[model samples]
Target: MKFLHSADWQLGKPFGRFDPDVRGALTEARFDAIDALGRAAAEHGAQHVIVAGDIFDTEGPEDRTIVQAISRMDRHACSWWLLPGNHDFARNGGLWDRVRQRAGDKIAILSEPEPRELEEQIWLLPAPLIHRHNLEDPTTLFEAMETPGARLRIGIAHGSIRDFGSSGETKNQIAPDRARLSNLDYLALGDWHGTLKVDARTWYSGTPETDRFQRDEPGGALVVEVHPDIAPTVTPIRTGRFQWLNRDWTVNDKAAFDAECDELLAKVDAPNTLLQLSLAGITSLGDRVAMLARLENDLGHRLRHLAVRPDDLVGRPREEDLAALSVEGMLGTAATKLNAKIDAGGPDGVIAKRALERLFVEYSREEQA
Candidate 1:
């Protein structure tokens, strides 16, 4: 049986951290990625598509978001199995009901711990979230179930693997030994947001689209082709529209800053990429302003998302530099004091120092008027 496995769609999520326009595009791009998944399934002649979990970002998505999701699932008439993750649990008046109201027949809402037989030799065991947090091991139920004769047991769930220290002290912990214990042919997992192979039989399909600027591993889905008594082959498929790049650029001079900017701009596919540039190291205010202006004016239209983070820059300010600032009284004093505090306090104290620096900037601007 040929099946498409994917997870972590995160639809209707508010990308508030990004610029308003870019956030909108990023949210919409999720649906486009889902559409691409449906197209891939149709092209591959998949009998069923299994979404391990996290179909939506929230339990209560906007009506339009629900409509868009249903439309994409309907595009392929093949059976689509959806399991709810921690993000979209089966709470009262949740997205599951909305999905039922829209794509009832076309999709199977596996929002409970149950196994449904899809074909003569295919059984889908879904471990869905009853609440936002499930302390018990959901896979334990599947382990107790009697194996069907001449059938392919496929287990689906969303949680963290025990042995995989990818995330620390996070909820939804899945025992790594579950796949071996359950003796399932294929175990599709979610929540890690990266394609991983726990074992030959167990695998994490990961998020179909990229959402955050995590530098752990690239995000994508898995396509599994299973034949009875034969080893199931899994392939990674890239579905994300935008490439999320997170890099620390150490700027000590104009040449270094320019080179770093060039490197970042080169990474972008332009108009289709989201970039988070974190500036580090010491540089003059003149160089900082020049780089910021260049990024805002020159490459602003080329990139979909751009953010300037100067929190990491640290250096001792020359007294002569402060004297030539033309600011007087508390504003200048605060700027000098804040810079000193930032340098002495180290990286952990930079955020508080930045707050004081902003106040100083505001005071200086008001005094000039």
Candidate 2:
């Protein structure tokens, strides 16, 4: 049996940290991931798409979110199996109930632990979450869960495997060796937001689209092919529209800095890239101003989002930096005072250094004008 494995759709995620427009774009991208997944299913010849868990970001999602998800799932020819995870656990007359009412016959909400037969000899053992956190392993019953004597059994579940997602706490933990214990051909998992392999037959499918900045890179879906008495084949297929990237660079001079900047810009698809760039090492204040200006004017305008940290990219004020301020005017006077305060070293020095850098940036902008 060949299927597309995905999870953590988080349909109504607000993304409050970003500006309203950026937040809307990111939110829409999550939906776009669904369309991408549908195409991928057709392309990969997947008969089913099993999302391990966390289909919604919260238990109480808007009707619009539920409607939108179901509508998209209906577009694909393949059947979609959605399981409730920690974020949206199964509750009586809750989110799952509403989804069921509107969802087409093709969509199945695996809100129970019943064994569902996808085909004549293919079985899906879903250990859907009933509570937000279950002390006992949800898949524990798989050992005794009955199926025909010679059939392919697949287990789908959510939660961490031995403290996989907490601060040394095993909340909703799954046994590391559950697949072997359950006599399953494949075990599909969720909660971890990056695709991962846990043993030969078990895997965490991760989120189809990434939401956080620090998650494992290259978020996408997985394609799995399995049969009884044979090892399952799992392949990752990218279905995300945006790229969340983090980069660190060390700078000592303008040439090296410019080279690095050019290289980075050349590598990324700017409109789809959200970059968080941090810099370290010492460079002259003049070059620092240039670096920041280029980052703001060039990269910032092109990239979907840009966050820069220049704190450790310390600026040592040079003669030309001071010379540009005109050594005899109010600009020069303010620069001298701020520079002196920086030398004195205190909370005031930090403020002075920031002010001086701003002065350089403003002056450079005006000079260009």
Candidate 3:
């Protein structure tokens, strides 16, 4: 049987960290990826699409958000199974019921621990979450669930796979060998936003849309093909519109840093890129100021979002830099005192760094005027 395994849609995420325009684009991309996923299912001739968990960013999503999601899922034109996740847990609210009302027969909610016979020779055992955070493993029941001897048993769940050291593994841990213990043909998991293969029979499809820049491969779905007594063939298909990047660089000189920045810009398509940069090592205070000016003026306008970690970026002012400022007398005495504080490292050293940068800025602006 040919099926599509995807999860962690996280639809309706607010993207509050970005500005209004960027936030809209990011939230819209998640919905856009749903259509892309549908197109992938059609291309692969998938009979079923199983979204392991976290269909929505939260249970309290706006009604319009829920309606739009259902409409997108309906466009797939295949049987789509959505299991409840921590974010959209099976609560007392009418969120699931509202979805059922709009979804009709094309979308099915696997909100139980029952073995559903999806096809004549295929069965699906889903362990849907009832609460956001459960101390017990949600897949524990899958180990004892029974299916017909001739059917291909598939387990669907949303949690961390054990021994993986995932950030939330300790809270919602699932045995890494659950597939072997449960005698299943394949196990599809979620919660970790990265494409991973835990074992021959277990895999995570990751989020269809990239959310963070944690260095793991995201933004894809797994097209799985299972036979009665053979291992499933899993193929990852990319379906994200935006590119997320986290880059780290160490700069010893201004020229090298500028070249690296130019190369990064050349490689990424700015309109669809979100980049986070971590800079380390030392540079002259003048060069540091120039680099930041470029980031705020030239580079910031090119990308959707740009974040820089400058804590490790130490600024060492050269004698020429201080001399160029040309504030002799009382102001010069202040500069001399600040420079001394910088030489002797302390809280005063940090203040001196900021004070010197402001002085440089003031002098530079005056020169330009």
Candidate 4:
């Protein structure tokens, strides 16, 4: 039996960090991912698509959001098994009920811990969330749940595989050897927001669309195929409209930095890419100023979003840069004090560096005028 394993759709996410136009595009892309999953299912000849959890960004979404999701899923002929996640936990007459109202027979809400027959000799054991956070492991019940003639037992759940000593991993901690403990053929997981392989039989499908800046191979679904007594074959299929990338670079020269930026632009289709580039190392104040201008004026426009981190990127003032700021005037006097502060090197050095850059920029503008 073959099926698509996916999770963290997070439909109706406001994406409030972005502007109205970009936010709209991001929210729309999530709905579009449903169609992508449908197409992938068709291409793979898979009839069932199991979304482990988090179909919605919140438990109570707008009616229009609910309608949009149902309509898109209805377009596909195959079955879509959606399990409740932390964001959209199960309850009496809640979001899932509203979904059930609009959803066709093809849409199966796995809001309860039950084993449903997928096909001949195949069974899917879904452990759906009832609350936003659970103290006990959701998949613990899969151990006792029995399915008659269940040749392929695929457990679907939403939680962490282990406590990584992090605050985020505190809730919904599932055992690392859950697949083995449950005696299942495969285990599909969610809540990690990144594609991961827990063991030979367990895997996290990640989000179908890229959302956050952390690059964890976010844009994909795991197409899983299982046999009676064999390991499941999991293939990651990319299905994201936008790419969120984070990169770090160091600048020692202006021309080299420009060349590096050129290389990046050439490699990435900037129109569909969002990047947060953190720059470090040191360069001349003039070159640093020039690079900042190019990044803001030229590079920023090319990409969907460009966030430059210039905290560690120091701009050592050159004689020419100081000359441009004026050698014997009020501007020069202020520049000298700022330069002294920079040389002293303390908490105030950070502020002085920025002031020096602004002073140079404004003076250069006046000089040009």
Candidate 5:
């Protein structure tokens, strides 16, 4: 059986931190990504599609967001097994209830702990989030289920796998041992936003499209193909429309800063990326402002968002430069301290720390006038 495994769609999300126009664009991009997923499932001839969890960012999604999601799923005309993660828990009056009402008979929402038979040979063991948080292992119930005499025993759930070293106040934690004990051929998981493999048989498909700045792993979905007696082959498929690039560039000289900015700009396809640029190391105040202005002017239109870090520009400050300035008191002290820190050979500690210092110095100068 061929199936598309995906999770954490986070539909109807508001990028409030971004500019109004850019935020609107990001919201639209999410729907576009979902449309792409549905098309891919149809093209691949998938018998069913499994969404581990987090179908929506909130319980009350906009009417348009909800309509678009249902329309896309209907387009596939195949079984859609959707399990609720922490984001979309199946509480009374929750988004799941509304979706179930709208979805009618086509969408199968697993709101309880039970095994659903998709076909004679295929069975889906669904473990859903009943409450906001379930500290105990939710998969324990399935561990005792006598392996159904089916061609495939697939486990679908949304939680953290304990043995994988995931630490937090996580609810509905699924231990690695449970997956092995359940005797299922494939365990499809979600909650973790990065694609991870717990064992040969268990996998976290991650979010189809990412909403954060984490660059730990490539964000995408998984396509799993299973045969009756053979091991399932899972392939990671990239489905994100926008690229989130986090880069650290050290500026030891004017030429180096300019070159690094050029290199960082090259990675962006412009008007298609969400970029966070962190500049570290030491540079002169004049060079720092110039770099920030240049980046803002040249790449602002091309990027969905841009964040500049200028704290590391204080390496080996020329004290004579500050002495020559008409400014005095706190402003001069801040400049001197910033230079000392940058000269202390801790380029990797915190890029934002230096950026903050530079901000204070700039603000102090303006206030004193």
Candidate 6:
């Protein structure tokens, strides 16, 4: 049987870290991913689709979000199973009731740990979370759960796997080898926001849409093929609309810095991307000011969001930089003092360097005006 495995839809999550426009686009992308999931299910010829857990961002999402989710799932027109995750656990029965009312008989919600026979050959044992947090392993029952003869047993669960998602002290843990002990053909997991494989039989289908730049795993679903005798094979498919990037660069010279910025700008084909840029290395005060001006005027507004972390970006006023500033008398003397302080290298040096950079920026802006 061919099936699609996915999880962590996390609908109605507010992307508050980004600007208003970017936030709206990100939130919409979550919904957009649902549409894409249905299309993918049809395109990949998946007979069934299973969402491991965390169907909603919160237990009590807006009613409209629930309605829209049901509406999107209706398009798939295949056997769809949703296991309640920590984010939308069965603690809130009313939310699931609303979902069931809207979903009708199309989508089945797995709210308990029980074996569900999808067909004569396929059986699913789902461990649905009823609380946001738990001290014991949710999938422990899978070890003792029995399936009918000549059936492909699959375990569906949501939580942190052993040796993952914590520093050896995580709650809601799943045994790393749950699939082997359960004697199952495959184990589909959720909770980790990245596609991960634990042993050959256990796998995590990360969030379909890319929300943060840190998760290096490609955002998508897993297409799994299972037969009566052979081990199930899984393939990751991309389903995200926007790309999340984290670029860290060290600019030691002006020409290299300009080229880097130009290259980054040239790659902006879409307006729904998120970029977190961290810049370091030493450069002249004048060049730093010019770079900031270019970013503020030329590149900032064009992208969905741009965050520049400049804590390690040092501003060294070179002799040529000081000459370009064209200050005289007391101002020139103060600039020299600041430069010496920067050369000394201490907390005061950082303050002095920032003050000099501001002076240069103000003067340059005034000249431009």
Best by lDDT: 4
C-alpha lDDT values of all predictions = 0.76, 0.86, 0.84, 0.88, 0.74, 0.81
> Per-residue lDDT tens digits of candidate 2, residues 80-133?
999999889999999899998898888999998988888887889999888888
Residues 286-337, model 5: lDDT tens digits: 5665677778787766677888775555533345556634265765665566
Regions of model 4 farther than 4 Å from truth: 164-170, 216-218, 326-330
Residue-level lDDT tens digits of model 6 in 252-333: 7778888988897787543766678888988888777777677677667777778889778787877866776656566667
Least accurate 10 contiguous residues by lDDT in model 1: 162-171
Model 1 regions more than 4 Å off: 91-94, 163-170, 216-219, 314-369
Q: How close is candidate 2 to the true structure, as a TM-score?
A: 0.92
Residue pairs clashing, model 5: 134-172, 271-302, 283-313, 311-354, 311-355
Poorest stretch of ten by lDDT in candidate 5: 162-171
Reference-based TM-score of each model: 0.82, 0.92, 0.94, 0.95, 0.83, 0.94
Candidate 1: residue 355 Cα off by (Å): 14
- lDDT, model 3: 0.84
Q: What TM-score, to 2 decimals, does candidate 6 have?
A: 0.94
- Model 4 pairs in collision: none
Per-residue C-alpha lDDT of model 4 across residues 269-318, encoded as one tens digit per residue: 78888888999988987788788889999999999888899888888778
Candidate 4 global lDDT: 0.88
Which whole-number lDDT from 0 to 100 does residue 264 have in model 4?
89
Better of 2 and 4 by TM-score: 4
